[model samples]
Target: MTSVPMIDEILAEFLQSGLGIHVGTRNEQLLPAGCRATAIKVEDDGRHVVVFVPKSAAPAVFENLRTNGRIAVSMARPADDRAAQVKGLMMFSWDANPDEEALARAQWAGFLAQLDGIGLPGIATSSWRVFPCRAVRVKVTAVFNQTPGPDAGAALP
Candidate 1:
């Protein structure tokens, strides 16, 4: 695996804010599955990220990652629509720890608050608690800017 540089403070802040987190994976048959991540944890070094997914709501996505490692994750800031997309190989996927679960719940709450602040109809907080969740670690291979404008879709340096 290629060693990518640790994410900078700007991107780290964007991710830690829990604005938007979506994860996608594909099955052996090439069928795609995606689910919103309830929580995102960027390791201090920024070389890795773990996304928590509710087992009940994203069984297919979990299964896909378990069966096939290819994965893509996208995140966007609700305040300004600045966004990024990452494609990577799954490094690990397992039941989330208690701390991870708690963090995810808290982050989900923050995400909802951001939505509400923006005058958007927020999803019920209860919706995030399907329980028996899994946390998947991704080793990023490529990243692209997904924000609108000329720089959109360009590969990140």
Candidate 2:
């Protein structure tokens, strides 16, 4: 099998920094499902991204990933609105590991802190649970610049 292309340093850092992150998947019937990811872990030199989604809020997304591998994830910086979207194929879905669980909690906290730092109210407290999560690993197949401007939505090389 051909190896996946690695995400560049800038994009990798953006993903790992707990910015405005959302992950989406479609069921076999093409019904869409999405949720805000608690954290995103870049592994294997950025060829793989594992997204942590709450079981409470997105059980349908988890089930969709199981039935169909297609996935789309978007991340943006709240400060600048710079963003990117990745479209990929899910390689695996499983329970979050111990370390992953911890990281997700930390990231989620940091995300809230960032919002507060910018004078925005954080998400509802009840929406921030870290346990009972599913980790969906995706092999990125395409990257696009979602930032507004002349090249908005253009596929990245």
Candidate 3:
């Protein structure tokens, strides 16, 4: 697939729609690893994104990024199953600042609200955590429609 260097308005909106984000990567041996991301931000240039994952939740995810630089981010609205997947290469990562930590808190709150609206209780999501995180930056290579349908997996133009 030809790589699109920028994200458009529609896709950008969808990506920030208070959906819970999940990130995945594979090590040199192609072993898969993944974990939930607390928050995400699309850069102004539309080609880069920063995802905040719990500082200690999944060490393997960080290792995979260092080993291969590849990442796949999947996000979906639980209510309707609308979804998208972003494929990219890791650009850099750093410990999130206090302000970024606040952003993560807000993002998780929104996610919890969404769950409540969908009739899910907060207790069921108690295991989820967000804070003291490292922001993984990715330079987008491609995006795909993952919304369960005939057009699922179709690359976004």
**Which candidate gets the maximum TM-score versus the true structure?**
3
How does candidate 1 fare on TM-score? Answer: 0.87
Q: Lowest lDDT 10-mer window, candidate 3?
A: 122-131
Point to the candidate with the largest lDDT: 3
Please list the C-alpha lDDT of all candidates, in the order they appear.
0.79, 0.80, 0.84
Q: Give TM-scores for every candidate, taking all chains together and pairing residue i with residue i.
A: 0.87, 0.87, 0.91
Query: lDDT tens string, model 3, 6-109?
Result: 77877887787778799999999999999888888888778898988788767888999988989999988877889999999999899999898887778777
lDDT of 2 by residue, 41-60 (tens): 88856688888877776678
Clashes of each: 0, 0, 0
* Superposition error at 127 for model 3 (Å): 3.9
Model 2: residue 152 alpha-carbon error in angstroms: 2.0
lDDT of prediction 2: 0.80
lDDT of 2 at 102: 91
**Residue 21, model 2: Cα distance from true site in angstroms:** 1.2
- Give the per-residue lDDT digits (tens) of candidate 1, residues 3-74: 556566678777778768788888988889998777778777567788787777667887788787888889
Candidate 3 wrongly placed segments (more than 4 Å): 1-5, 124-126
